[model samples]
Target: YLFSQRAAWKPALTLNGFLSASKRFVEKDLEVCVAGRTFMITGANSGIGKATAIAIAKRGGIVHMVCRNKDKAEEARADIVKETGNKEIYVHILDLSETKKVWEFAESFKRKYKSLNVLINNAGSIMSQRDVNTEGLEKSFATNVLGVYILTKSLIPLLEKSPDPRVITVSSGGMLVQKLRTGNLQSERGRYDGTMVFAQHKRQQVVMTEQLAKAHTNIHFSVMQPGWVDTPAVANAMPDFHRSMKDSLRTPEQGADTVVWLAISEAATTNPSGRFYQDRKMVSTHLPLAWTHSSALEEQKLMSLLEDLAKTFQPH
Candidate 1:
């Protein structure tokens, strides 16, 4: 279970913890070095997304925040500006849960911004009950997996414009699950366990990322887990999870550190695509069972599903 309120989880990240983290990881000055680099971060109004946006902005990079709520995005941008004194941050409306809207937004974005240096697919949700979007897809799958698929596909041309394009998707440690239910992907025929279903989708994201890497040689694709960052999504999913893992969880700023590392670090340019990463370093992932876990099969199914969905909306 995760806690839904911020008040309940704020105290867990103390000054001592921040100091310990700075010692463990290389402290960077992003603004001086990261200027000119453009980044698109989803769910940029709060939690990990907000932290990542601020981190990129502070580093002197242009951060285009894609969030669902305009008001919340403005508030987040204001705060980042106040803290970092960087006014290059821009906000764009995008709701990943709504498949059609996401495509429309992505097309508009590409038109406005000719080239995107990095695309961070970080927005996600873990709903209490099963819910479907306007596209008639499961809410979790729509936002976490399918939305990412469409957005990445829509932005391919823009991404290709850059000298070296990178797609860094935020996956989860929970992706080490049993199998994917290709038959009942929406959980329409059976029960929906929040944790299990969310993990399955996250796993799908990792495998899909690998497949994309294989399919496209020019684009660099990598997936990362932020190590159980304290966020509202977790709190909303399971009410008790926050308190239980208070000491072990990382702060949003700390969590976004690796995201920045993957996006801008010179070391990442040489790293191979489709690798699973955590805490700013490469890591091993658990191999899944035969029928449910093949990268080729998952990629094929996802592409077919997304292509059909894309047909409904006219791309800009």
Candidate 2:
């Protein structure tokens, strides 16, 4: 089933094609009309998150830029304001690497915004060595997966208030080759493999979105791979590999286009919940045979773990 979807799907050409295909992609600069709608994008001070915030602001939307660094966020805010000429964008301090702070940030964010039209789970991490956070969880899992889970749960009520609520998680194509190892979820059992840990966490996101879509009918849930965007995250995470990858990589603005498209496009109205996307087109994320038939079972187990953790940590 998944393979057929992969076979039938073709990625949305280039942003260059979309740009040349219509004056609107140019006039609008590929930004969708988030005007009047509210968005909360994590890691919004840099990389693809910054671009996504700027894109939404360009279309006249209210953006809550969540970041860990206040000074960096202020710089990003200034750059965005200059680029978009839209002052609806604001910044919030959120170190998603910390679970307690994620919940607090969500509570404060909900109090300020009446409705949340979009939640872009754009923040992520890839550590060279296993680092445990204050919460005693693996840093990558805590920041990339658990943080997203808690933040989304806390904001679900706000999402319910919106006419068209969307949750777009930025996952990775690396998940295609990597399977989750339940025994080493925290990389505690053995030496840390940076890329593998990131892949596992991203796969966890896909599983979480799948469960969220199943439970929440009104809230649109989807995941997207930005296809090797030339961002600092990539540069810092894999300096050598990225040097070669950069030749084919998209700019941050180009990476931001599909995310903005998913948030506001008419196509989203009928799109299936929990679908995976690459570029602007929907794509299948099939588990490889090496993953064994137990892949589906593993996804279910991961969902159960996340739910249990959410209840234990955020038992409101």
Candidate 3:
């Protein structure tokens, strides 16, 4: 099944096959309105995150663009407002790598809004070299793993207040190559490869989704891999791969399709939670490989580690 689904990536088949698949999953003609719904999207200034924000805004959803750069975020917000004619767009600036900022943003958001319909953990980084944040955590692991964990943990109260609460995390197809490293999450013990570390973080996201879903059955927790998309982030982070696959890569709209669908589609909410999706369909989280599968003991250890890390970062 994985190999068959991967056929959409073949150069000769992508234009016809993948493009059409994207269109079908986009829910373009579906009249799903989220007029009163509120969404918070991290890293909304560019790439798939911006595209997801626009899709939600077009459906009359209140969008809060959580970004690190104020100017770029406001610019994107203006563009969304002009294009979608949805003036309910807002912006909050914070560097997710900063644990303190992540906690503060969550608290501030909860205080400002009565409810949060969706929380999109879309912000991510692919560092070429290992870098540590002020908190002395590896940059990619801090932003992609710890930061998301903290933000989601802090916002549980606000999400529970919503009529249909959902948490949609944007993971990556790269994670299929990696497995959870329960003890060495920060990659401190080995020679660091940025790509592998990034993939590890993505794998962590899928595990965290399952853990959260099990703990909070009332809130839907879904993580998805936006297939290789033609975005600025890709060009910057993986230039060689981008150069090779640029012609056949999916557009931002294609990448964000399932994200928007999961956010508002009744079909998605009704489906079982704690699943990983691609192109609007629930798919296997790991490929058939010896190292892909982790023991239940490892999963429990990961959950415990994440919970401890989140609590350590929580504001006093």
Candidate 4:
């Protein structure tokens, strides 16, 4: 029975990959106007995040570019303004791996803006070696999972203030092979493989999306996989994969298609919440692998651990 349920998703996996390659899934009919709506995207300096930011800015949305580097962030913000002719683009400096900075940025954002229409947690990294930040958390887990949790939780009040609020988190197709490691949330119990750890963090983001949707029913919480985009980060992080797939990979704009759609499209907002999506359609979160299916208990436990971690860093 387990095998049958898991096998059902295999076709979806294959179809999704084909759609990504052909670029047939881009949302081209987006006509929604977000004139005064606020959108804050992390890692807005480059790659999929930057692409999503520019797309939103072009629609007259007030985009807040949250990035670690002030210079790069400013450059991107300027380019977005020039291209979109929308001057509401603002830049905020933040290192998401550091929990303190995430909290500080969220608080500062709330002070400046009355309503947050959308918050896209798009910043993530893959470390070749295991490293810990100042908070004693694994670097990849900290930035991808905990930082997302902290920022999303902190900004919930702001999101609630909007008429149609949404939180779109960029996960990865790599998560299909991972299951929740409940006991070793930080990968402290066994040998650490950076690739697996990154996948684990991606899985956590999807799980968190499910829980957050239930906890905040009014807000639309969606997690999506960008699906093998040809970004500079990919080039640097996975050189061999980049070299091999250079001809077949999707562009950053192609990857950010669903993100922009989810942010503005009325059609996306009408869909159910807490769903994992790719190519602008809902996709299965697990594959046919025996280890890929996680129990409800495991998901709940993961949520509890993440909530506890976020509480510790919540600003007083």
Local accuracy of candidate 2 as per-residue lDDT tens digits, 160-238: 9888899999998777756665656778877778998898888778878887898898999999877667889989999
Poorest 10 consecutive residues by lDDT, candidate 1? 1-10
By summed lDDT, the worst window of 10 consecutive residues in model 2 runs over 6-15
Worst lDDT run of 10 residues, candidate 4, spans 9-18
Point to the candidate with the largest TM-score: 3
TM-score of each: 0.87, 0.88, 0.93, 0.92
> How many residue-pair clashes does candidate 3 contain?
0
Q: In lDDT terms, how accurate is model 2? A: 0.80
Residue 186 CA error for candidate 2 (Å)?
Answer: 1.1
The weakest ten consecutive residues by lDDT in model 3 span 8-17
Question: Residue by residue across 112-182, what tens digits does model 1's lDDT show?
Answer: 87779899999988877898887688898889888898899889789888867999999987775445445
User: How close to the true structure is residue 261 of candidate 4, measured as C-alpha lDDT?
Assistant: 86
Q: Write the per-residue lDDT of candidate 4 for residues 106-222, one digit (tens) a residue.
A: 888889779898999999989888889988988888899999999999999999989899999999887887877778777777787877888889999999999999999999999
Which tens-of-lDDT digit does each residue in 1-316 have in candidate 3?
A: 6565345334322334456665555444346899999999999989899999999999999999999999999999999999999999999999999987888888888887898989999999999988899998887888999899999988998999899999999999878877888889888887888888898999999999998999999999999988888888889999998998878888888788788888988889878988999778888886653357888889889888878887887788
Q: How many backbone clashes does candidate 4 have?
A: 0
Q: Tell how far residue 286 is off in model 1, in angstroms.
A: 0.7
